[model samples]
Structure formats: C-alpha cells, structure tokens
Target: MTAPRFLQIHWLASYPGTLINRDDSGLAKRLPFGDAVRTRISSQCLKRHWRTVEDDWALNQIGPEMAVRSREVPEYRVLPALEAEGVATDEIRKAVVLALAQALYGDKAEDVSKRQALLLGEPEIRYLISKVSEIAAAAADAKSAGEAVKTAFKEEKANLSSMRKNGVLEAGLESALFGRMVTSDRAANTDAAIHVAHALTVHAEQGESDYFTVVDDLARDAGESGAGGIFDTELTAGLFYGYVVVDLALLKSNLGGDGALAGKVCEHLVHLIATVSPGAKKGGTAPYAFAEALVVEAGSRQPRTLANAFRQPTAARSEAAAAALAAHLSSVDEAYGAHEKRHHLSLQPIEVPNSSRIGLDGLGKFASAMASA
Candidate 1:
C-alpha cells in the first residue's frame, strides 16, 4: 500500500552549555510554553541550517545550488551581460529601471520598491537577460528598446504559471521544498511543503552568564595585573524538542510531480533533521549533536504535536523526556486509537506505542520507501 499523505517527525536533541539560537538582544531565544519558559530555536534558523549545509545530506546536493535572492540582479547580472553585447548604457538602465522593473518587481516607478531582495531562479534570470538583449538589439533607439522590454515582460508574466508547472523554473530545490512567496503575483508563489515548529526545551531553560577575560600575554609577562579584554556570553544546556510535518502530496506537486525526487528528499531530510544541529558558537561550545530520541509517524489523520506531553515540564535528561513522551503516546493511542504507522529510535530504547524500533539508516530508508509507495 502507498504511504499516507503526511509524515510527522519528532525529535529530542541536547546541546549542553551552548546557545543554539539567540534573540536580537543576544540572549538565548525563549518560549513560555506550559508553565515554564523554554529555550527556543526558530523555524527559520533550523531551515537555514538544513538548506545551506554542505555535508552528505545537503539539500542543494540533490539539485541546483540555490536561487539568487538579490536586489542587484540588474546592476550585476543584466547590465554586465548587456554591456558585453555592446548594448548602449542608457538603453540598458532604462530597460532595467523603467521596463524590467515593472515586469519583475512592480508597476511602481519609484526605485525603493525595486530595491527589495527578490528571489529569482537561474533559468528565469537567463531568460530575462536574453530577452532584454534581444529587445535592445531590435529597437531603432533607446526609447523603443525600453518599450519592447516592457512588452516582452508582460508576456513573460502571463506565462509564469505554465512555466512553473512545466518545470521551466522550479526556483531551485530550496523553493520547491520550503516554498517561496511572491507578494505581487500569486501565480509565482509556491506553497511550503514542509512545515516546521519552533523547537524548545521541555524543561525550564538552564541558562548561565559566562564571563571570561582575554589577557594580553605581553602585559602578563610584564607583571601587569589587569586583563586586556573582558566579555560575557549567555550559555544554556537542555534537551530540546523539535517537530516537523511533511506534506507528501504537496512535496511531489511542488517538485512538478517528481515522486522519486520527493522520496529522496524525504530520506535525506530525515537524516538532516536528526543529525544536523544549529551551528552557533561551534568553536567554543562544539554544540554538534544527534537527536537523542526520534519518533516518525505517517498518516492522513490531522497531524498533532505531543508538546502537551511535557505540560508539567519534565526533567532535561533524555531518559526522562523519552519516558514522558512514551507515556503520552500510549495514552493518546488508547484515547483515539492507533491509526498511523510509527517508527521510534531512542538512546535509551524506551517504549513508543504503535512504533517499530529502528536504527537511523533503516528509519530513513523506511520513511523514503513509504513516501515513494
């Protein structure tokens, strides 16, 4: 039988004496969930780490490098290409600012809105440059050339949906999986296939202010008692709970109905989610760690989080958290009936109801096969 329509993954990872995520105040991010304030990591931070990693399971390795998100595409890419083609400077800028701007960015004549960093696929970029060059080469003068570009862009805008459907520009792998929002055009927008929750510690945040001094070697040798520099940083240690839900159908649809690629992504993504840690102060804290406990479930039932498992704020120990999760799952199963298939992997080998005990490799492959099925 084919796998269910959704996959939900829950994990517990520990980062001791490390600030996995920090707020604008440079303090560890926090969430007041269930009676305690837990140290938290934002979904944006987690996805950025996974999307940009160059390791064996890197998302970019599966396809193209990345979509270019920039406000300098005209100045850097288009203008340079046009210059090499001997297009006049005035024509190029006018097309970029007056014509191409309306087509790609907005109809506004102002420059500030066009300055926003917009995500453009490489294929789309190449097509734009080629069209702009052709328009400039054909026109009798600069003014006509600018008008031609605007006309060409209008045609391009009308074909956005078909181009995306036909895989002319999937907007890179990142956009296909995580999604992209085009404020001006709904046709250009791709809905997110993977939904991630902000990860937070189950217990109260274990935080500390670490103060240290960097002494000058010469000053110390010269018998000076004062330190060269003094600084302090916040550090926290706790077992964090992370949850992610993958819409299998949406993933395939976003990838242009490529089911095999979708399966591969789910597999690699499972590994990435379990093994990858948010890299913050790695040199000092060495915060790298694997999930201490993982529970992956597949079902069509409306997805739910087990966050309430720790409503009383369990201890930070892996065993304690794992036990609490197991008990909660058992209670949930008894109350609602077990309808989904589940797989569990834990450092302590705790019981997770309706789940098969599996190793990391086996779990990834199983999830992949299920997604493909």
Candidate 2:
C-alpha cells in the first residue's frame, strides 16, 4: 500500500459567556482530561457543522454534486423523474415505489417500506430512474411493467455482482469525507476518510450559571404582578482546542480520482474549520466565534494530536494556550522529526516563540499543497 498523505489541523478558539456544547442534563459538556475538568464538544456536533457548510458550498460552487440524506427518495427523486417522463399521476407513485423497493431490496423488497430514508446522490437517482424507465418501455401495460420490474430486480438479486457492477452510485464529497452506511444494502456503504477529535478546553475552569428574567411586554405594560418569566442557564468561558486529520489518499479515492473535486473539498473544509462556529446555544447566547489561531500540517508521517498539550491546562486566555500548543508541537517535532511541512495563521497578533508564522493569505496555497499531495 502507498504511504498515505495526511493533513492535520489544530485551532484555538475562545468564547465568552456561552454554552458551546451541552450535555443531556442541559449543562455544558465537560470531561476530566489530564489534571483538570475541561469543557468538551462532541465530534458529532463538529461534523454536523462541517457537513452543513460543505453542503452549502457544494450547492453554490459545484452545482448539485452533493448528496441528499433523506428517506423520501421515492417521492422526491423517483416520482419527479417519472412524472417528467409523462407517466400517469396515479400510476407514477405505485410503480416508482415498487421499482425502488426491488432495486434496493431485491427478494426482500416487500419487507422494505417507502418511509425508510437513505443517503443517495444524484448519480444513484439517475441510474435507478434509467432502469425503471427501461422496464416501463418494455412492458405492454402498467401491470406488466410492475411485474417486469419485479422480475428484473429478482434476477438482479440472483446476480448481485452484476447489479453492483452496473450501479452508478457515486458518493458525494460530504459522504466521502464522513461516510454512509446502508443497512439494507452493504454495497452502498462508504468508509469515512476524515477524523475529527472532540474539542476540549485548554484550561480547567468552573462554569457559571446566569440567572435572568424575561418580561412579557404586554404583561408589563398592563401592570401584571411580579416578573413575567425567570430562568437560569449554565455557561462557561475558556479557550477551546480543536483537532482534525484528513487522509488525502482515501479522500482522493472517495472522489473517484477527480483531483479538482478533491481540491475543492480540501479548500472548503479548511475555510470552514477556520471560520465556522458550532454555537450550541445559537439563539440564546449567540456565541459566534472563529479560531484565533490555526495550524495546518501536511506530511507522510503518522498523524499526531496536540491534545496532550492541555494535560496540565493553561491560562484562561487563548494566546497562552496557543503558545503552549506551539511549544509542545515543536518539542515533538524536534524529538521525532515527523512533520514535513507546517503552516500557521493567527487571527490576532501573537507570536509562537519557536515556530515560523504564515499569514492567512497562505491558506489557499497550503490547501492546494494538501490536495496535490
């Protein structure tokens, strides 16, 4: 196997008076790491934000290359295509639903329900529609078309290899990065190429409870007794550290060796990580913040995370945490000589005592280098 190319990204972001990620108990998620309790944001939350950003980017930049994750494929994709082809309104729903079931479930198609959602891309939709149309064209009537569809898929079930070989189920970039699993059909599964670590605070600090009251304007104007509402919420303030790694070789394969698409994916991912904020309490606290410091590393060495730098925790501010992380990384590189290239971008004016700094302008260049690798 060829050595895999990897891109490692680390960032330090500070939020004030915010519950960036909450637990089931409605408290900010916290974890006991190293010597102190650190605020934690789950990888699931981060990936959700990343996927949302990627989907928007794909729609605006790439034009319909992103997949839709839904269970209503029969209604949204199949029915629409058949309708456009002049299939009768009444016959379209039953025919397409039956065709989809057979195409996806084979002999067990009857057990499959139309309500089950699946992660499908446009390519897969088009392929299914083509097969259904072929069966429809060959049939003498609607009833015959339905039977022909079932028979065709039953034969396909007998020869699973031929079915898979002819299936044009192309995974989109988001699916390629995060992956998908079809319980009904294992062949549709895509292995994820990107790994994200749960973000943790760089310092240990106790969270604060904000007790405030909201008054109904009409009640207050009408001279109602007492306050309209009173409530309390838990929030924390600290410098959070995030880490992510991308397997370039796997990403390339996921994009079907399309170098250009891979480049776009890398670029958008980097941009989102640097600027996007996964505000957990979006409407209430509105903790919209971006990374204060970002480091991107690309190399052939085994990927490493800087989470250990926070084992002892740092000062409350981001600058101290950023410097500590930079120092720790430098020590590791000196001892192991691992990284091939490292680049830094700081939103604020801060200096790492022992590392070279790259301006934000170099992000595009770094992303290009990562994609080409």
Candidate 3:
C-alpha cells in the first residue's frame, strides 16, 4: 500500500448574484474581470450567507463518497437490496460498508467490520447489512457463502479494535462528522464521486452570473458606464482560498498504479474552477479566481486541514500563517482609514436596498475615497 500523502487545503472566495439582462437568446450574459469581458455566473445574490451551511453539508457528503468511489463497484446499489431482504437498515448499512471495505481495503475489511458492529450496536439492521457485505465479498471471491459469513463474523468478533483504529486512518477528518464506519462502500463511494462532480459543475455554471450581476448592477448605479470605459471590463486581481485533504493512499489503492490519475484529478480541478468562474478569459491575461499557489501540509484536522485552523490560529504553523493574514488585513484597514479621513465619507458598512438594481452605486463610497487620495 502507498503511504498517505499530505492533505492540501485552499479556498475559493466568491461574489454572488444573478445577472438580470439578457444580450441574446440562448446565450449567457457576459461581464468583466480584469480588462476583458467574460461570461458571468452566480450562485445566488445571497451566496455569501449560504456558504456557511452549504459547505458543511457538501463537504461531509462528498468526502467519504470520494474516498470510496476510488474503487468502482455497485456498492450503493446494494442498500435497497439489503432492505428488500428484510435486513435492518442499520445492518444493511454495515454490510455494504464491509463490502466496500473489503473491496477497497482488502485484508483490512475483517477488522473494520468488527469495529463498526460495536460502535453501532443498537442499530441491529445496519450491522446486519454490514455483515452481509462481508458475505457478499467472500462469495464474490469464490468462497462458500457459509464460509464467507463465518469468516466475516469471526474477523469482526476477534479484531474489533483494529477495525476502529483503521477507521480513523481511512476516514482522516471525515470521521469526526460522519463517524468512523464505512458509511458507503467502494461502489457507493464511486457513485458519490460522480455526484460531487456533477454538483460542482452545476455550482460553477450558476456562480458566473452572480459575479457579473454584482459588478454590473453596481456599475450602472454609479452611472460609471462613461464612454471613457471606467466600467469597461478589465482584468482584476482575484484569489482562491480552499481546504481539502486529498487521500493519496486511497486514490492509489483504487486507481491502481496509474500515477496519471493524480495528475488527472489536478487537471479536473482546474477545469472545475474555470467552469465556475465567470470572469475567466478564453486563455488571455484574464485570470480566474481559483488557485494560484499550491502548498500541501501534513496534519489531520479532518474536514478542515491545519490551514483552515490557522484562520483562528493556535498551533505554531497556524500562528505563523495567522500572523501573515493579520498583517495583510492591517494594511488594508490602514488604507481604508486614511481614505475615510481624506474623503470625509462614512466608512461604516451600510445596508443597500435590495430592489434598486444598480451596481455602480455600490462603489460610490470607494470612488469618493479614491478621488480624495
């Protein structure tokens, strides 16, 4: 088995809202990023507010699925089959987990099954399903059904702790929110990966218009559509901050020794970013607000890596990153303060009306400050 790889974390900061005007039929509205106009995408005008909850659900659901999908089998399809057999959902859940564990984890399935049995003792149905998983795997391998069942029970009973411990390693950070059992086996996991890919694609298409609308509405409000092209599209600096733990060991185990799979994943990542970002030029100086620099750190904070924890900062590495963040924020704060004094404009955050669809008006405060400077 390949050793675990360091987890990578980053963020994608977004501006949210939908573009109102349509230029032509069947065509998405275009907007500017730096100097050139590109297509606009959006999630919702209230996108920022939704980010808090959406990430929680999306990450939890997607993480485990991604891990299991590494081994492609029809694991998810087994859930209803177990239910049809009168097996309890709890057992069915466990059984499918074991099946996945056996397929992806190989010899490790036995111990993993036992640990799950104990943790979910009351969920008899789920546990039963889990038992079935082992049975199915053994059967698939040409073992007698009775022998497979026997081996599953024996392994589960004998090496319960081993199962639990391995669960921690296999799950990494996901264990915290979803518990350390094979929630979805390899097949189910593979299905989940496909689902995540689709969801991300949908998000990107929706998000483009959101950014465009925010900028355009603001521009129109300020009447900055001057012939001088003050509101004309131009390349603007953008950034991405994301955090995800890529399970290299899991990837290798599922994808075989094909090292290209990892690179393929990276390429797909770039594609996803471009798809989501509206301002991305068709290969010019227009840069998408996705990833720029790549840095991976070793440490398990789970759902969130050490970098995310650094947002608040407690540990040494975290503190270092935090210090940098604080310094940057401070510089921006100082600049804003100077502008407020010189322009005599209120620096206070004010609520703007929702219906007055004007983008230019929003920058009024900033424009005043700039003139004064």
Query: Best candidate, TM-score-wise?
Result: 1
Tell me the spans in candidate 3 whose CA falls farther than 4 Å from its real position: 1-9, 17-180, 183-240, 245-255, 273-373
Per-residue alpha-carbon lDDT of model 2 for 318-370, expressed as tens digits?
77887788788878978987545777888666665444577655764676567
Tens digits of per-residue lDDT, candidate 1, 125-151, equal: 776777777777667777777777776
Cα deviation of 81, candidate 3, in Å? 4.2
Candidate 3 at 258: error in angstroms?
3.0
Q: For model 3, what is the C-alpha lDDT against the true structure?
A: 0.32
Runs of candidate 2 with Cα error greater than 4 angstroms are 1-4, 54-64, 80-117, 129-154, 157-169, 348-355
lDDT of each: 0.81, 0.73, 0.32
Best by lDDT: 1
TM-score of 3: 0.26
TM-score of each: 0.89, 0.81, 0.26
